[model samples]
Target: LWGEACATLETSVGPNNFNHWIKPLRLTGLESGIAHFVSPTRFISDWVNRHFAKDIIGVLSRPGQPVERLRFDVVPQAAPGRARSAASGSAASVRPVASAAAPATTRALRADLGAPLDPRYTFGNFVVGKPNELAHAAARRVAEGGPVGFNPLFLYGGVGLGKTHLMHAIAHDYQMRHPAAQVLYLSAEQFMYRFVQALRESTIMDFKGMFRNVNMLMVDDVQFIAGKDSTQEEFFHTFNALVDQGKQIVISADRAPAEIKGLEERIKSRLSCGLIVDLHPTTYELRLGILQSKTEGFRAQQPDLQIGTGVLEFLAHRITTNVRVLEGALQRLFAHASLLRREITLEVAQECLADILRTNDRKISIDDIQRKVAEHYNIRLADMVGPKRARNIARPRQIAMYLSKQLTSRSLPEIGRRFGGRDHTTIMHGIRKIEELLSEDKAIAEDVAMLKRLLEA
Candidate 1:
């Protein structure tokens, strides 16, 4: 009966989730509607009870057999003088109980070394655009599960930009390509917790072996270990061991390696030795594409719901922060329409998402633009609004004029009043000059792009 139920569960949850959460469970007995199962640790037990209990009960409760509730107990280990029994209740729930008879894969899962991969985040679901095309290509190259030309593929970007999504996609693709390979993916915080636990229990050697033996190791949000000395030391060793053994390592963070404050310089250099890819801020076309893709998925779920034209375009233009916020706005709109049994229209959307629209409305001022540009170019604030015709001051002043025109709704004459009472024609010339240089000079383009990101952020 347990074998049959296990087979059914492998189909319900994806293989990765099943292997991580369900495969380590051992059903010892079933009586009086209480199914007793022994788990390697409390974490897996609680996770199964919360997420997969109903599904398991549904499959196990047949006509002749009745199973309702699940009672979990940690696996027992032999002590100094007392022999352990399978039915004994032990308090060692946090640490894993290793079995000599268990297979290597099952033992690894029992160790709880990694987090579950999200089935929704995969290469097929990822949308490609100019800002993220290079990152996407690099992720695909690593997912081939072969020799990683770039050992540790470092992906960094601002929030909601696709770092976690691409990380999960790589893990999924690599697992699919090499089913027998040992792939461990976890957050840096989890790494810290495990290291601390091992230190407390004198199992540091086991922890090191488990981490160093993996075929692929991925650590997300690595900036979390920046200031900690011990965790950083262990992580550096783990990183070096994997790279030296020709194993693949993938890492993600919110910023570039060198830019992460409190991080060790040696660790940053190691991270920078590989191919560093940044998922740039999403473009307008990219946001629109994401909305369209999400709308299609929602349509599948709500086939009868009607969405009006121009709604997506309006959302794409208004919600310029990131992909998550854009998708969330769309989701709220769909839910509002479905709950009210109303067709989605532009006015209805505006009415439904008034709060989101209001929050996303960033009224950038010309003064703010001038201040930011001056600081970026390392010029004085007075020089920004004063008569400084030197190349350094003049170039930044022109860039400030360009940004003010692009970001704010001020007229050219009104902007002229803010910049040392210059004429409207002077503002126009400065704006035009910057525009021409944006296409002709790569440095100016990069500077403008970086400034735009800073302002938006």
Candidate 2:
């Protein structure tokens, strides 16, 4: 019965933790529904009682015949082969028991759960820009904490916008300052997988205890937990427990909580309780800053690689969407130049990144124009395509149709077909309307210029 309880606890608390805490105890006997066990030292016995007693009791309790109590004793023997490190306390004492008794399956699962963080994602390396300054400030304040000013600091943004970078920086910062504070950083998929594993093994209490005891919890890409009700419910409780106790909780996702489809309203409201910062697409200046910083870092590694002055400006202006891609382009350029014994000039870069550069330079399609215009005007894609008499979708859709005609080689009917199967006459009318706007409104001309630059780049 004691062995079975330990197995159940192992499944719930995770193999690494189970091996550390429960593997060393000797099951002396069971009597009157009471289980008695002995540890190697008094410290181990007390630590076990403090952290795992309630969970142990819950695991041992069954439908009808359940263990009512647990007893622990300290016994000194030629220390068990599995002994906790003296510094790690009694938990480390159980190391041998895990080595001998732990299954290969358990070891593999533990390895899967022990995902190492990327070392490059430190606070020192993160570049702060106007778009992410508020998020950065909020994260800094949370890291230097007394009372929890924000229950759950939610950061959302498009891909490659440094959402994950900021979250890692926060975790690394807190861990360095407060070494004793328990920090658990995992993706929402990881959380859900662990929860489901615990459920299958009937060790929900163990699962609850693992997350509940943490002083800081950071979950990345939380939108993955949107439709899974059981996982979401468990996460909600874990979130509240940590927040109610004034512990720091941080989450990152691609969109705002409310905008995340299928998320529970209560969970969304809880997420919105504190600061919710959105990381916008990097501006040209911000991209240049990132490129300059990245180039300097690269230069330290390869002092001989000569990246010309206007190279960064050209790259920054061209690769405008994400910082990651920009860095990748630079890396590719450096590698190609170094291997081929060539100068890292604009011509070499253009050759090395020909595929990416070509895709970047390709003229905007009619489809892309419609999508971008609809997004800018805050109108639905369907409404833009539909015969809606409302000016909201109609005007923007017309502007998109005009841009497509002026920008691409598509004929009138072809352009119309791309915009909800309208006739060539409709396309002509839309183009005329936008042309009139361009002549009268400076704002419209500026918008056209910006869109053209974005599309061309």
Candidate 3:
């Protein structure tokens, strides 16, 4: 009866969902209008109950087996290499992959709930430059699988800056060195999800056991849990427990701990206690190196594709936002050439990636305009956004407002906010005054033009 219902669910919920959330469950029996089942973990059980319980019950509550409600229970896992006896009848049971057994628990958590680690994100493929050298070195030291001085190693940076790559590399290296050591890697979002599930199911103890039992825990994009109060509290305790037990913790976020708004100060202080490393934005040389490395790898797959000289360099120069965008642009070029049978030249790249190129073009920010305008007139930078009405300060402030309006994509209100919370009407007045000066006074026009050139440069 359970088998039939699951077959119907496989189609209803989709294959990936069925396998991850449904296949692990075993419906033992239906009695007294209640369906009883055994789940590998409370996390999966709670998820299945919340998301797919209605579907399962709907299918089971057919003509014969009437299931009024669904219940998911986590039974004790059998010892390794021991199959359950037929005598243990009626109730179906399965051992959790991350059982509370000695030594193998970390590998089990890694198998069951940890985010899938990318095989390509190892240190071997990580391109090193001055920007990321310190981060790479620190990760390498931690991955050496020794007792390190830092209890928690925090890596923070903007998107596509290799924070996740380093985190994966550390896990891969650490697991390889100590085969029996328990290592678990997952994102902060997953941590919160499991915590939420554990709370819902009254299985908080199970959740604590799974997390704190690991020898090493790596959580990526921890900034996601910033505003989540309960998750933050659980994470703080988990963090402290691991540190108290002398276990290693690796965390990655998009920004520094102090900079993440809505995060508790105590959590910030704990995260800051570690050796915090920032993976700086990629330099042109680093981007070129990455492109070259990627192209070399691509050559093995498409040996016939001809790439012209200076194409990689051109891409490196143009795609300066991050490494991911740089690699994605290169991949698009490869795909274009592979499909069209054309050589990948600079001209072909420009023609094929016009939209990307346009979007990646030099972006001017309000901060840049304000700073340049302030410098050009030799007034303090603070005065550009300050509450002052003097002529020297007010003139450059208006010029900055005019240039910001001209150069940036920001709305008037946003621009006004950037200039120390001035209103849009005030911004409009300042911009108009600058426009009147630009047309009538040659000096104002020349100053605006010169500032524009400097800002662009």
Candidate 4:
């Protein structure tokens, strides 16, 4: 009866988990409504008891072989080579009179050992727009932990554009659905730091054992691993091992994989091998939507304060850099208003965010951008500003027009006159064309992001 129960337990955990974890636990006894087991070491005993004891207990407490509870202890003289012979003795182990009817539930997430998850970054708080809708959807899919369409969901974009937020949101949602999930989330820098620490301590095997065994792995700002040869090498192997086991991986970066300088070619290849989604720069409406969402949360906190309309619109229009900065500005304004006991209005927005608005001032010119775009697309400078409707010239022209509207303070009419004396509606149409491409066309979006970075720098 015990042998049949052990076989059932083995099938429940799969071969890999059974061999590594179950093969070591020796059933010592079944007495006084307690089923006692011993492992070779405290680490193995604790790990098994934490991760697999519930299933093992369930099998042991079957109708034939019953046990009220499971207990694990370390065997000081137990040897790994002898576990095969000794663990079989567990088959002859005795049974208890009364058994615990309920089995232990799955253990909680191992989030404490890695980076901590911020409860506020869940999907409910994320504001979606055309720019970030794809990213948001992909993240939600990965969180579902079903048939993952993408192996490593790579999310890259400008700073404070919700890469990390989406990553955290995935972790939170996944763990919520899977209580026993071994979900690990941390920065690339922390991974490197631990990799180095493991090397110095000669516990590299243990480090690899823990990391490579997780169900889900998320590394934020993976671009940070660029240029560090040893860290990159170790991370590559770790990433491959997890993916080979069909584990889900989520990564975030400030730029797309190919654009990150100093990163290894093979790593880039592997990173891009999976689904790559970019959280395009926030649209004005998206920014306003985010402000409104955040303001509602703040209003709930400070019920007495009545916020005016133009304040959020003003901040959303002015602070165009990143979502982090935008949220921070609103939070700061709310704090100031609460402290002063005043209503949130345009004057308050101006006085409170004066410094941030200055920094958000336009940094690029339409002409400079046209020149840069011309050089990038291998066309003459005059082609950008001249009357040329050819695909080769027009595509780059529209890209430049899009960048102009995004990065410069030029009006549509002003931008049109610069583009071969075209009308404002032509410029608007061109801008709209690029906006359409930004979602459907990857090559064009990549080019625009690269050019924008270069011009900003």
Highest lDDT among the candidates is held by which one? 1
lDDT accuracy of residue 48 in candidate 4: 70
- Could you give candidate 4's per-residue lDDT for residues 1-457 as a string of tens digits? 4566668877898877787667656676767667776544434455576678778778777575567777654332322244454235444543231221211110111222367667678899999998899999999999999985688999999888999889989987876566445677899999998889879978687678768867799999999999999999999999999999999999999888999898899889998888999988887788999999998898888888767778887777667778998988998988998999988889888888878766776556788899999999899999988887899999999999998887766789989888878999999999999999999999988888778767754
Output the lDDT of residue 37, model 4.
67
TM-score of model 3 (CA atoms): 0.61
When superposed on Cα atoms, how far off is each prediction in RMSD?
A: 8.3, 14.4, 13.0, 13.2
Task: For candidate 2, write residues 1-457 as lDDT tens digits.
Answer: 5556666778887887677567656666556777666554333454567778778778767777677777764443343354433233233333333333324443234323323455578778888888788888888888776574576999998889998888877776775466435566789999999999989988676667667756788899999999999999999999999988888999999999999998999999999999899987777678888888887888798788787668877787667666788888988987886787677888777678877655654546777877777777788888777899777778788888877876565789998888789999998999899899999999887887677545643
Worst 10 residues of 3 by lDDT: 80-89
Summarize candidate 3's per-residue lDDT along 1-457 as a digit string, tens digits. 5656667888999988887667766666677778876654444555677788888888878577577898755532343223233223222443332333434433333345566566578899999998899999999999996766466899998899899989988877776565445567889999988788778978777678878877789999999999999999999999999999989999999999999998999999999997999987776688899999999899999999899999998887667676787888999999999999999988998888888776765467788898888888999999989999999899899999988877665779998999999999999999999999889999989888778656643
lDDT of all the models against the reference? 0.81, 0.74, 0.79, 0.78
Write down the worst ten-residue block by lDDT for model 1. Answer: 80-89
| Candidate 1 lDDT (Cα, 0 to 1) | 0.81
Ranking by lDDT: 1, 3, 4, 2
TM-score of 4: 0.61
Higher-ranked by lDDT: 3 or 4: 3
Q: What's the distance in Å from true for residue 305, model 2?
A: 1.2
Error of 3 at 100 (Å): 9.9
Model 4: residue 301 alpha-carbon error in angstroms = 1.2
